[model samples]
Target: MDRTDADGLFPRWIAHRGAGKLAPENTLAAFELGWRLGWRAFECDVKLSADGVPFLLHDATLERTTNGHGAAGARTWDELARLDAGGWHSPAYAGEPLLRLDRLAEWALPRGAWLNLEIKPSPGTEAATGAAMARAVEALWRAHGAGESGGPAWPLLTSFQPAALQAAQAAAPHLPLGLLLDHLWPGCWAVARGLGCVAVVLNHGLWTAALLAEQRAAGWRTLTYTVNDATRAEALLGWGLDGLITDRVDALGPGQPATA
Candidate 1:
């Protein structure tokens, strides 16, 4: 897609991990909360279960968010689905089951929500995770008729792992991809270009006026993550960022003023 095509597909404000810090991250409950709060674009992490089912999760282990132990990817979808994924956040969301990507697609596609699926792979499973997730997303979008006939944009696949993004590109070249970076690692830009990425998502602190200008000149969209402060958000927007993935869903969103 050209820049204009890409522009129509994405929004300026994307809710990080669904509802961000409000609800359990990467759950349907969080997504619903974001939707209610007027966020149409969302960014979430995706990994493949041992059974090859793609699901929403951020960490390699389940200890932080879910009531489970050990590697999340080690569990099959059947096993992972039974875990209480919300109680760690609060009592009201207790018993919220782990969400499969297909379920999320079923909910978001019909509603025209844009998604940025970050391919978060567990150790030793980068290639498998990327390939599986690409296939899953492709099938889901095809089934729902998304990104066609003027529907919602196709979900963007992003990752910190070059191997994973490479596998994704091989699996579904039609899908748009982005490279995630925490810093300007050597050869990172070259890798992103080689992978045919349309954008680059960076840590909020990594952006500068000069960097933004360079990226714009290079014809790549620029986005940053986890920005919650209104003052900082204002600065980034003023610098012409394409998007901001923020945790302050309740406070910062489309049409909401940037307040301190």
Candidate 2:
């Protein structure tokens, strides 16, 4: 649970969408809620706005999660920012604002919370979006990374799209990257190696004890997704998983440091 090591091993409990189950997901309200609950690390989905700004959002369309409708990528950041991100989740969060990744970084950097920024593209913009996000990350790191002394304690980049991962590597080689997979693909390890990624994030169900063992032996860290049950978490820990991304941050209790 001690994440102070150089291996970029994750915190024991990661709040999905900035404490998704606790508050309006991907909003500042949710992140604040998680931080208040003593959860410092979180996972969030990011996509490029029409103007190329990175915003926190999960769905391809805005209708389900936000007060807007239509493809999220089709809108400019100005347009997206105007929507009420929290109202749909709950009336209590009616005025909650849309969160920008950079703004979140500014907030999280000083707090020692780790962030897993997932590169989510809008349709045909996969490579372009990835590159844009990578460039943004590069700038972010330049402005706030450890070497610069203004960044978060740890910043991790992840993507299911290989092109996006490649873009991140090209844009900022110093930052750690994680390859995401829902199912095992041919040469998955090789692909990860080629991208110079530090970890492989797998769908919880697709991974087996054997797969976990294999990935760990290869010197690649393993993290699973959306696990909310304590028993399941303990089981995965017994399997030697490096991290678990979950919607139930409250269920994790207080996590131990990675060095522990």
Candidate 3:
């Protein structure tokens, strides 16, 4: 599909890492909460375990989000699945297990929810993680009959690592890709263009009216991340942003008025 066709699949408001700060990030509970609050679009981090299982997690290490220690990628999925992924945030979510990508696809595809699956590879495993995630997502979506006539749109795969995105492109060229940028590094635009990305996701502060215009002129849809402030969201939307990934799901979402 072309840029316009792809743009239709992305929603105006995307819940960041599931329900953002409201629940444990990257957990199934977080996604459920976001869905209940009327968010149809979500962004989550995906990385491959040592055994090549693609799972939901943002950090390279397990210390922050889970009860496990050391590198998360070093453990196989069987070990990772036993960790209390939700306990770090609160007791109410204790014992919430790590989620596999297939499980997420199973829940999301049937609901027709849109997903921005960020390929957050661990250091030194960019290519492997990307390729693995692409293949896994492709299989999961195919099994659910996604991308068929009148079916849900395929998930958009995005990453800050060029090698990861490139590997994903090589593995599944039909999947939509987006380049994530925290800074406008030298040759970043060139890299994104070379990857044939349909969208460019940037830090909320990186956007300006001129930059937005420039990207749009080049036929690339522009989106920003973690925007929780109402005034900033209003400004970005007024500047014609294609999407906004926000943590404030309760206050800023579909049919909800933005408030400070």
**C-alpha TM-score for every candidate:** 0.96, 0.92, 0.96
TM-score of 3: 0.96
Once superposed on the true structure, which residue ranges of model 3 sit more than 4 Å away at CA?
1-7
Q: List the residue pairs that clash in candidate 2.
A: 1-257, 1-258, 2-257, 2-258, 2-259, 3-258, 144-151
RMSD of each: 2.6, 2.5, 2.6
Sort the predicted structures by TM-score, highest score first: 3, 1, 2
Q: What TM-score would you give candidate 2 relative to the actual structure?
A: 0.92
2 versus 3: better lDDT goes to: 3
Model 2 spans > 4 angstroms off:
1-9, 148-151, 253-260
lDDT of 2 by residue, 103-197 (tens): 98788876677888899998888888777777777676567656554544446789999998898788677778899999888998899999998
After TM-score superposition, the amount by which residue 195's alpha carbon in candidate 1 deviates from its true location, in angstroms, is 0.3
